[model samples]
Target: MSRRRVGLTGNEAVALAWKQIRPHVVAAYPITPATQIVERFSEYVAQGEVDTEFVAAESEHSALSACVGAAAAGARVLTATASQGLALMHEVLYIASGLRLPIVMNVANRALSAPINIHGDHSDTMGSRDAGWVQIYARSVQDAYDRTLLAVWVAERARLPVMVCLDGFTLTHSLEPLEVYPDEAVQTFLGEAPTDGYTLLGGEPITVGPLALPDSYMEFRRALAAAMERVPQVLEEGVRAFRAHFGQDLPSLVDARGTEDAEVALVVLGSYADAVEQAALRARVRGQRAGFVRVVTFRPFPTTPLREALGGVREVVVLERADTLSGLGGPLGVEVRAALYDLEVRPRFTDVIFGLGGRELRDEELDNLLRAGPPGGVVYLGVEGSRVLELA
Candidate 1:
């Protein structure tokens, strides 16, 4: 297996990975932050670098619809979008997953509109969290590239749509050095596109996406839930294969650091976790038992791994970019708290909300926050006006 080190933005890295995968179809609508991914992949299509049908759909909905159709027809399929574009695909997001189509999508995570901000945040993907897709977040250009490829494998094996999310401009536009594996190595690792599932092109009479009556609808939903439960096993299998073939150690679904014996831990997702980790490291050098965990896989929510990581910690701070708007902290805070609720010696947890609409989490600010320890409830950091919102 050969490898080359190269400089690329997160979007370019993802596009290059797709080129190597050479899926049968890519249907997408260009959107800010995420547009460059499809733009670069389209160039690959035009230059004949890969034999793929590129469909420039009129809207994000149409783009994902095309991908759903192609995937249902037994073609390997993918697409890219962000913010409003991803919101537009919300309805079809469930359709793809309900039909169990192995469609993979890349989302340059961006803030949703109301005041029309186009910056990076987890709001877009977290908004569509219940749409039944395998959600994976990346912290760097290399993570974006490797995880996009990993998402494809997980999607196919789990028979569910996978969303590979990277921070909008933060990761998508920032340049970084990454290792590129040989095409044959990647191809050999992924093997062939799955063909055992139901397909429209199978040349047999079959009912696809039929309306299930009230009696059977519950069963269908239960089956989808069961499929999600089985994904951790399938995802772990792919990670092992990828490690063996590419000699690259990808982060586990729950990427924990310094938490094995640390007394304080911060739980976060996407690139923001990198900042928290750096601060935690400094705190450790200063004799503070501080640690942080980056959640790589958000969907199916890695409850078991998280429990193991935070089980013995004395205090936990969950910092999230998007608010749950429930006056109960953020989406991740709610989930993490629930995940650790049953622990025998539960940590004193606090929810720190920050980085909404691409707000930067500065190192000094994070350093200050880490030194303060857990506040024992919900606190708003870096936001003006109201600083702390105490939850009853």
Candidate 2:
């Protein structure tokens, strides 16, 4: 398949991929970093390049509510938001998943504001981790494009909503070169949303978002969990299909490098993983066996793959993009430790919480992490105060 190569920011790449998917409905509100995704996609809607219903909702809550209605109505739905905008959509997020509506949303990860920082961070998506959604993190603009297209298939198969998360300014605003498959290839790969799932549209009238009372509440929620349990395999199949169709090789869950006999390892995500990997390579040249793992899937939390990936390392440092505010560790830190808890021999763990609200980690900063070994406990990087968090 001949592909078109173009330079695009993550937001623009998402817009391009969503255009190729050509969803039936898009109800979105503007928020920093994420706003451009819908903005450019709306342009395609206006130009009649795609026949999509573009609804400019009043707020993020209304945006997702509209998505739930559309998805329930059996329309292929899409939306985008970041930070506080996502916080506003908190309630409807689970409702979309609980009702088994496969709504695909693009989240440009950003920090929640008190002092009003409009920068990239995982706080938004991390906070919504338990909302019954499949979260896929992108490592580059190419991934932002590829994952957005693949997410439609994964979400429909999982019978749950999916969030395609990309770094706000890091990838969302920076342009990079990537190949987009021919429109026919994309169409064939996506195929069509399956109709076997429960629906509130077309077929017999079905009561959705029903009052489960006590008797069926757990069952309903359990059904959603059961659906999520099937996502990892479904996603793997989707990746295989995508590879066969587009000849693009992609790791479905976790991307691990140099883990074999690795003495030191760093776990990171999004674009930051690139920097960490480079630092690991540098350490390798200096006679240290270092590696890094990127957790691509966040929601279903691929514990099995992560555990196996970290198992071989003697020392592991979990680099968290968002603070858990627990005074102990960040979200990813807790997850890593929990994943490796039962392993017979696990890597020594250290949590470094940094890069909130778009703090950039220089190559040297990451290099020092491996060279210096574990910091013993939670270390707050890039903070000048040097007082809030103490390294044990």
Candidate 3:
């Protein structure tokens, strides 16, 4: 299929892809960054472009709860939210995954509120990391569109919920030209949903919501963990299929740039990696063997792949947009340290927590930060009066 370039915001790209997927049900509440996704989907339903049920949910929690009900009935379901809306739906988020409902969601990654910021950050999704959902991050509008289609396929195949995240405001509201594949391409790539005996029927009664007893609870939890464990293989297959049909190869876990024989590596997730990649390139041009790794998949954590990528490095810096306040560790930093725990020759590592609440991360700043590194300890970029620690 021929792909045509269309200028679209990240949210619009996601909405367009969801339309092609033709979900049976969509329940969403309007929220910053994520509002446009449902708005566009609702328009498609209204225009008869999609023959689907569109439910305008009263609240974010209700929206996710409605999607869970629809998905439990074996309907392909979708929803979107940002920041506190995502937090509000936190309870059902875990339930959706625990029940193995396969709901695909677009999370316009935004900062969680205290004083309240409607802009982009990883805090919202980071807050829900324990919700048992597969999380995928996109760096561009095109990736945002492509990943949404893949998320549905991945979720249903793994029988797990998937969140395709784009940095709110930064990517969500940023306009970019997207190469949208035809509907036939998407259908060909994703194939059809499984016709299992899971759907809710008019007269046929089947028990979906059941009380779990202590006798079977542990077994059920183990099965869910097993399903998540199988996700990497399913995701790789889906990416291959998607590339065959759409001519775009999606990275399932991480994208490595100039890592061969590198002594230092900078690691980041989501859109910020784009900046880091450019910085790495500039560093490389100056005869420094610096490299960058962009993590695309966050949940199930991608430990093995990351450890393999960082094994040869002498120094590493982890750039995180989300913080684990209680632990005094950035989310990505903690995960990176955990991945390197058993390695015999671990690199000097630094945790750089920056770009929170939609603050911009400059390429020059990243280059300078990486250059002046023992690469140990925490540094907060863009924060006033922040001290940079040089660990011995």
RMSD values for the candidates in order, in angstroms, are 2.2, 1.9, 1.9
Candidate 2 structure quality by residue, lDDT tens digits, 1-392: 89999989899999999999989999999999898999999999889999999999999999999999999888899999999999999999889888888899999999898878989989999989999999999999999899998999998888889999999999999999989888888899988877764677666888778788999899888878888888899999999999999898888889999997798888997889888888889999999998889899988989999988888778888887898888768998888889998989977888988898888776766766666667768888767764322221
User: 106 in model 1: Cα distance from truth in Å?
Assistant: 0.4
lDDT of 3 at 129: 88
The pairs that clash in candidate 3 are none
Q: Per-residue CA lDDT of candidate 3, range 1-392, in tens?
A: 78888899999999899899988899999999899999988999999999989999899999999999999888889999999999999999989999998999999999988869988889999998878999999989988998999998899999999999999988899999999999888887777777487567535787775788999888988998899889999999989988888889888988887777888898999988778888888888877889889999999789988989998899888898999995556988988999998999998888888888888877666766766753478778767665542210
Identify the runs in model 1 with alpha carbons over 4 angstroms from their true place: 386-392
> What is the TM-score of candidate 3?
0.97
Clash count, one per candidate:
0, 0, 0
Clashes of 3: 0
Candidate 2: stretches off by over 4 Å: 387-392
lDDT agreement of model 2 with the native = 0.88
- Candidate 2 local Cα displacement, residue 73, angstroms: 0.6
